[model samples]
Target: MIKIGDFNKLKVKRKADFGYFLDGKTNNTKDDILLHNRLLGKNNINIGDEVKAFIFKDSEDRIAATLIEPKAKVGEIAMLKVVAHTKIGSFIDIGLPKDILVPFKARTYDLEKGEKYPFYIYVDKSNRLAATTDIDTYLTTDHEYNVGDTVTGVVYGFQTNNSAMIVVNNKYAGVILHNEYFTELKPGQELNLKVIKIYEDGKLGLSPRQNRKEELDVLESSIMSYLEGNDGFMRFNDKSTPEEIYTVFNSSKKNFKRALGVLMKKNLIIQNSEGTYLK
Candidate 1:
């Protein structure tokens, strides 16, 4: 049987001027899929040869088969680039002649062209090949992952609280709370995340922070750099607002104070109500 949006082993039944027709096991040629000559590469095909072809509908909505493997197949996840946008939906290049549509209803937000984001490929109810940014719905929580395991993921979106919704390893659902990260994360950005907790359903709670000592070191360095850049004086101090500290050092107010304390203990800086200065 020829299944659209999936691979099928079809037997070459007849030859045509443009290509060969692979039998769809139905009575007539109407269901026969066209396996174009160009798709066969340098290998010659003959009648009675069985080809493992990926089946899909072309731009014309006609059943087509290809020997070339797409970047991702149905029921899989991949980082696909948005190629075009339309009122109906956006299109993504799937390493095929006809790009796959990502219906607007399936998108969490408006996808910009040229930006690559992870998507889940699936056959819609209409039996059409489509991709979606609603990857959470497609990803499962069942995995062998454990807490403290480092995993890779792509930032797909942000919640109202600014937590990142991530597709871990392109298969599992994960999230990094806003407080767990000190930097701004954009959609489609790839990150190495540390698993802080595994939910009851197996969804991972992740963090992008490093060890306390390392983070302190980095924070102190950033403070020193800011001071040096400002002619050996810094405008922010322990009394600075949390927002100010975050904006300047991408850190929490408590961490900022700790870093400042470390710097002051080393006699590298002096802070007064006005601000801090190199000592």
Candidate 2:
């Protein structure tokens, strides 16, 4: 049985000057399938040979089979190798007889051949399967997000402001602000970040810094280790200056004070007019 918009393996029942004819029953009627000559030029296909064909619509609105596989469906991500380039666009070999086009307008920069690029496969207004290099413009979903929401992203490039340009879920390109960056980041790096904001223009904001739970845990652990390693005593008065606290813990004075407060709350230490000491 033949169905529209489906893949089918059919046998070549006959041949003609224009193409080969395939026999298959569709809705209990004998239908003739046209496999164009130009489409089989690369292969030596002959009568009685089984071939795979994708059902496509003809100009007469009839179901026709093509030797070319189906085009990339919407919302599909694929890694394709660059095959050639033209002034208007680059062609990518996406496991199909016909290469997909990546238009110049869809690119952030010029592309070169012999390189592999990950792209979201989409059909353009012209009904052609094309690749997009500028992915940020495509992620325009009405999804609600907020600060401290854990998300994953891939580093794409760097910003002059010291922020890292990242791609999230191949849907959006967002900036991880410099101040929010806590560790080293490089291009192609895949890391987890917290969503700092969802801009009105559909761009996402990310932060590499720890969230509340992680920050608290790190602070507590650092303070406990510092206190235990130092004979259970920390000069927490005027002598433990902000600079000294930062040098010791890589944290601000306020965070040091909060860690001290946690130690006091846990009855692990005591503070006096003289200085903070072990109880």
Candidate 3:
């Protein structure tokens, strides 16, 4: 059967002035789908020649076939660029003659032209192809990724508490929870992230940076900021209680010591029995 919103290899049944009619493989007379003249991509099609084409509804809401492969097909996800918009919806460039609509109701935020978003493609209630950015329901936790694996994603949505929700590899569900990274993330931003943990529910926890040297650099910077905020004197040291270290550093005692050690090695700070102070 020829399924709309998918690719179908249909035999050319006959030729007409407008274009060739493709056999829908169904007995119904109305089952013949059209491969319109404008959509016939340079191929000299003959009757009985099977043409592999993407099937979709044309502007007139009639079934049609095109040689143009869309950015995504039914039940698949992809990053699609916004091309135009109307009061009701935003049109996406899916590499088709007719842009696919991401209905206003399906959008999670205001759509902007030229911006690309990870979208889920599906046939809407009207059986017409559409794209949607509100895709959390389409994401699944059944993934092959493991901790420490490098992955890329686009920021699609945000949690109420400022966590960034990401669409990983345009399919999997991933997130960088609040305060996971120091930088504030915005929608449509693409990021290269590292998988930090896989939850019991299979959701992925991600981090923006991972190298030990890079982590140390960030920690050192945070320590300097803390010292600057406290008049260049921090009343804590390696000998301080873990609770005291955590209260001041917002990190584990071990990490605090590492940052302090780096600062000491560089002679950027002086540690005495009284406390640690900037040199």
Candidate 4:
């Protein structure tokens, strides 16, 4: 019942100059795991002393335990930095001596060295620790989340239709449809998303924007800043295209117009066929 890739509590059977041999619960030294000298961690352990450690295979493929914690364990998600690459896959530094492998097929983009990305760790078919950017298979749609609830998530992949696939709370499946944002989102970007709708299939539809009033507050402030920086006069108006509005404000045309309307109502600005200008 020795579970690799997880923390295990084992008793010391014997000690050696190299390290202590942990009892594998089988009463056999050959079946014992070696807690190497470097992993002793200042503890003067003796036989029959119970110690907790993370069990894994060492460089020699021998069962080993360490007091050091990995950045992420199997069945968990973490942000890891790419340190090196091979023809078959890339390795990420996961706070362990052996970097975890992220195969090319499991990557959303061509991973480059020195770049950090969100990766989900799991045991591969060979029972070796591996990571992947394709995390949908690990995400569940059934969750207790409700509309309007705020949750944290990471962008793992993009749909061909331009939607962003998100894993919410590291477990629930969610997405931000193409119409939700004016800017392009990339993989591995973390977001604090607001749940907009819970689909019939239990999937969540999320948005990055807040409610209308709160959105207007932000947009209004943005407009004021732009006007202030522009000497109180600007040329963009209702005639501006969506792309133009997005380029200037990083917001949708509808939100831009709503912000303009509020400004005009406050008598802070006036608009004509030519453009909008501060009064």
Question: Which of candidates 2 and 4 reaches a greater lDDT?
Answer: 4
In model 4, which regions exceed 4 Å deviation?
25-28, 41-44
All candidates: TM-score? 0.94, 0.47, 0.78, 0.89
Clash statistics: count for each candidate? 0, 0, 0, 0
Better of 2 and 3 by TM-score: 3
Better of 3 and 4 by lDDT: 3
Instruction: Put down candidate 3 lDDT per residue, 120-192, tens digits, no spaces.
Output: 8999888889988889999888899999999998899999998999889878899998766656577788999
**How would you encode candidate 2's per-residue C-alpha lDDT over 59-82 as one tens digit per residue?**
454446677655444465544578
Residue-wise lDDT of candidate 1 within 143-212, one digit each (tens)?
9988888999899999899999999888889999988987888889999888999988888999888878
lDDT of 4: 0.84
Residue pairs in clash, model 2:
none
By lDDT, rank the candidates, best first: 1, 3, 4, 2
Ordered from best to worst TM-score, the candidate numbers read 1, 4, 3, 2
Clashes of 3: 0
Instruction: Give the number of the best model, judged by TM-score.
Output: 1
Q: For residues 1-279, could you state the per-residue lDDT of candidate 4 as single tens digits?
A: 877778888888888889888888785668989998888766777888898877776667677887778888888877789999998899998776677789989887877789777788887776677899887787889799999899997787888998999888777889999999777787777888999999898999999888899988998998889889999878898789998899988888998898899889899999999888999
- For each candidate, C-alpha RMSD in Å? 1.6, 9.8, 5.2, 2.3
Off by over 4 Å in 3: 26-31, 218-261, 268-279
Segments in model 1 whose C-alpha atoms lie over 4 Å from true places: none
